[model samples]
Target: MQKRRRFKQTKTLGQRLAEEVTRLRDQARALPPGRSREMLLRKARQDETAIQIESWLRSPGLRAPT
Candidate 1:
């Protein structure tokens, strides 16, 4: 008999944020044109922008001020 090894699941902040952005976009797309849908889409855009900024900040190519 062999026991299966279980690995702990974890998500990084960037990954979690990216997932939220995806979920929001999906939900927004499923809804008809309305104020609520607009709000969700806007939120999704904001999250996506944040993720981009986070990636940029962590980029190895980025240089500090001289």
Candidate 2:
């Protein structure tokens, strides 16, 4: 039987997502305005949204839906 490979993440999800967003934005900025650039920007926006949601979830003000 093959064992699954295990690895530890050195960075938190928020950190990873933030890095990805930064990378995507930088790539998009380097490209000419077009579908590829738009797609990269879209992905960066999604990552930013994910970061926001993660922060909101971890915030002390978060409450269970009544």
Candidate 3:
């Protein structure tokens, strides 16, 4: 009998941030308008902004000139 090996894959920072944003937005939608809802929406926005920034930072043109 041969042993089988499994490999685990890890999400990049951008992917993780995007998933978090999606979760926050879903939670906010389910809640009634109030402080908690507002907070969750705000956090989702922040995560979206972070994702944009991360994409910008990773863009090819921004790399230091070699």
Q: Candidate 2 — which residues are off by over 4 angstroms? A: 64-66
In model 3, the Cα lDDT at residue 9 comes to 57
Per candidate, the number of residue pairs that clash is 0, 0, 0
Give the least accurate 10-residue stretch of model 1, judged by summed lDDT: 57-66
Q: RMSD of model 3, in Å? A: 6.3
Residues 1-66 of candidate 3: C-alpha lDDT, one tens digit per residue: 999998675999899999999999999999999999999999999999899888888898886534
Clashing pairs in 2: none
Stretch of 10 with least lDDT, candidate 3: 57-66
Instruction: Supply candidate 1's per-residue lDDT for 64.
Output: 55
TM-score winner, 1 or 2: 2
Using TM-score as the measure, what is the rank order of every candidate, best first? 2, 3, 1
Candidate 1 vs 2: which has more lDDT: 2
Q: Which parts of model 1 have CA positions greater than 4 angstroms off? A: 1-9, 61-66
**Alpha-carbon shift of residue 52 in model 1 (angstroms):** 0.7
